[model samples]
Target: MSTQKKAIVFLADGAEEMEFTISVDVLRRAKINVTVVGVSLKNDYATCSRGVKIIPDVKLERNTFKAEDYDALIVPGGAGGAKTLAEHETIQKLVMEFYEKKKIIAFVCAGTLVAKAAGVPHKHKVTSYPAGVREQLVNVYNYSEDRVVVDENVITSRGPGTTFLFALTIVENLIDVETSNTLRKEMLTHENL
Candidate 1:
């Protein structure tokens, strides 16, 4: 039997391109199976924050995706995308289900706001985009200014610049530190970052 880990990335309109793309890229490089799910009911593609349109591998719907099927759930950030994710009832329920299943729930930049809306306990330490976004989550979570913060199965990171580390961190959690380190070296990310 194959032991490869599977992850699902939720994509909405205005998602941060780098966060979405890099997370998928790095996770695939680590040999993880990544399924991109479009949160939009209107189309199969999500128009990113910078106008990059990407067609997801699947559309999130009842009986289509489940928390038990994947090792992690990833949410990328953009102002509009985060708002959409935070407001979507199905997405919120999925977040809770992932939490209940003890699966990794990873968010980047403003995407961290979705955790607050989804009723994730506020005691966990987390970080987000440091400007206006941080203020909203400060009173709710044990907010930090660190580039990446991992509190148990929940992982959060800053903005686009921290995406590589954020994705690598997820890889570490799903696989192991040794695999993550090897990818870092192979990608020449070890010397650059």
Candidate 2:
């Protein structure tokens, strides 16, 4: 049987380009099977916050996407994308199912807000984009200013600037520290400013 770890990243209109792409790129490089799912009712391409258009591997459908099939769930944040994800009932249900199954759930920037709206059990150490985002998560979680915070199955990060670390953290969780470090060095991520 194949032992590859599988991950699913949910994308919505206005998703932060860096956050969504970086996470998927890093995971794929680590040999993890990453599926990009566009969470839209229309089943079309998702437009990023910076205006980059990406066609997802599949469109998220209520009965089609199963949480148990993947090892992790990723949500990349942009103000509009996060809001859309938070308000999407199908996405919320998937988040809850992932949480219940104890699978890794990673969120970046405003993406963490979707977890809040999904009602994933709170009090975990988490971080997200500051500005208008921190206030909402601070009271609900053991919030931090760290670039990446991993508490059990939930992993979160700050914003675009922190996407590398966030994605690397997910790699470490789904794979191993050795693999994560290898990719970090190969990508010269350790030398980033």
Candidate 3:
């Protein structure tokens, strides 16, 4: 069987704009198929926390794509957005399905709580922006203050400030060091990386 890499990024009402855009950009640069899925009925338009309005490629409910069809699922962080995503039953089911299939599930900032809400917790290292949130996750997973943390199938990062690192790490995980390194230089993130 041929292996094809596809990814889905979930967008909520108040998602972190930078995290979402950076991830999609980096993943696409790595040649990974990326689908932006909105978690709201008004999926065509989502206003991020910082007042950036974004139009998702499609609504999650309307998308024909299934969990098994994608290699990874990425969730961006924004307190309101993460809470909305965590409370949604459909997103919860999707996350659980991905977890069961051993697919990559990534999150940034407050998005880590979505994983926790989905009942996917491991002792492996994980991280989020807020120190308090990190402290809370430490009880369930080995938490760190690092900018990016990848443990098994779970990948996480701090927040908007680390969006590049987070996206590059995702590329590294889904693609390869060579591809990620090349993109880093192209994106002028080589020094920071």
Candidate 4:
């Protein structure tokens, strides 16, 4: 066995650039094998919310994922991207598979809606942007105002402002506290964070 950790980040048009890029950057910094996947039918580049065009490392195909091949799934949120993700059955299945396997499933901003749609159980503690909105969340999970909330294998964070914290938390989960802290110090990931 290679013993290398692997993660997949799914991207749709209008995904929040900061959330997707920062989290990927942090994970790569920790030596994780991170794959950026485009969700379009062609599996091509996705235009972000800020108009940043990103070419994915791969394209996701329905019924083709072997969930056991990866250690984590990450979803970055924008209004349009999250809506698209929430409506995709394949993405939903992938999310649920990761959850069922007890692997890390991380979401940022409205991406939390994707988890809700996938029926990923939460321990009544999760966070997302526009904190008061709970309409999308089911009765099983309660929303939190914290920057990032980790309930077992499910990790959630607020908007772009907290992307660093979100990414660092993921690093801690996949690697260790010492590595996460060292990266935090090296990156100087904001004074308040």
Candidate 5:
């Protein structure tokens, strides 16, 4: 309903610190109103994979919010983060609703499970972390085993090691490629975005 770039990220029990922070900060830098919504087991701060605690802007269990409040939902990857996200019925439902509307949804690293559980990619191109997890990612498993995958409104990136490029790709997804490239050029001297 509003034109503001309300981007909400789901921070479950163990999100990857880099994936969560990089995506949120870059989106904010690109002028999106980013909110870290914690999906905690007990309505508390989210504990990242790196052990850093993030106090959320909102708690999914305690709030009555619209999936439409945000234009996109970013799910960061971590062993526990992805597993926890994939198990949540509400989150999976919201993700499906967003995808059904053709809104943007992104998952980086092991978070790939959440996107899949939400049913975003039936057979489209997608990506995820390339370790033992690659074999388990949903759909197009053989396609993005090595690179960042962008299939229309659904974007996927490798992992925290690729956080910079991943965040920039998300910026490209929500805003425009030109803006993403410009920021990349500005951020990295030798970068050819």
Candidate 6:
């Protein structure tokens, strides 16, 4: 078999540990290459909200994502990480590049803010953790208000409570459902999601 395709998880100072790791881990377990990218303010390793420091796989200046390098962009939610990512000019540019090129964009938890800042316009439906940042996304429909809202190339989920669902949803987008289902079983996570 060929080597798995890759997805990138953008991180920064204060990335919520679980959101960051679980997102990357789920994709990895599904046999996709997950690249954890730490967009540090100091241009070095980023310290997670839980205190785990991670060295990014590539730097802002060195990334050759090209909108065709692999598959998707994953943004995990954390108050600090989201805040940092939202404020970074390079990240904004990269994300905009991703969006303009129609790459799959996945955000969970607070990561929605980052995506919104990159100009997703909230066109379809979206969900976010805590529900306070709805303003960032111009036209959002709460999933809990009804069903899981997936629009075009964008995917958003609530919070830690919805992380598993978020991961599976992303997998379904990046690859095949059979692969996603097999990995879901291996992780012992609900496929009903």
Candidate 5, poorest ten consecutive residues by summed lDDT: 138-147
Judged by whole-model lDDT over C-alpha atoms, candidate 1 comes out at 0.92
**Ranking of predictions according to lDDT:** 1, 2, 3, 4, 5, 6
TM-score of each: 0.96, 0.95, 0.93, 0.92, 0.90, 0.86
Could you give me the TM-score of model 4 versus the true structure?
Answer: 0.92
* Segments of candidate 4 deviating more than 4 angstroms: 41-43, 131-134, 138-140
List model 5 lDDT by residue over 1-193, tens digit each.
Answer: 2365777889987889999988888888878888888886444788788899888888888786566667888889998989999989888898888787777888899988788777665676788887867777643443566557778778888898787787787777778888787778777822543
Q: Which pairs clash in model 3? A: none
* Tens-digit per-residue lDDT, 1-193, candidate 3: 1465899998988898998889898898888999888887354689999989988888877766677899999999988789899998888888889878988999999999899888886766889977556766778988888999988888999999998999888888887788889998999999966
Q: lDDT (CA) for every model shown? A: 0.92, 0.91, 0.87, 0.86, 0.80, 0.76
lDDT of 4 by residue, 44-122 (tens): 6888899898998877763367679999999999887888888999899999999999999999999999998898865
Give one digit per residue, the lDDT tens place, for model 6 in 94-171. 777777777888888788888767766645577777566655554454343322346788888777777877888788
Better of 2 and 4 by lDDT: 2
Candidate 6 TM-score over all chains jointly: 0.86
Number of backbone collisions per candidate: 0, 0, 0, 0, 0, 0
Q: Candidate 2 on 1-193: residue-level lDDT in tens?
A: 2599999999899899999999999999999999888887344788889989988988776438777899999999999999999999988999999998999999999999999999988868999999999999999999999999999999999999999989999988888889889999999997872
Measured by lDDT, the strongest candidate is 1
Rank by TM-score, highest first.
Answer: 1, 2, 3, 4, 5, 6
Model 2 lDDT, full chain set? 0.91
lDDT of 1 by residue, 1-193 (tens): 2598999998899999999999999999999999988886456688899999999987776347788889999999999899999999989999989988999999999999999899999989999999879999999999899999999999999999999999999999999999899989988889866
Off by over 4 Å in 2: 41-43
Regions of candidate 5 where Cα sits further than 4 Å from its true position? 41-43, 138-142, 189-193
Model 3, backbone clash pairs (residues 3+ apart or across chains), number = 0
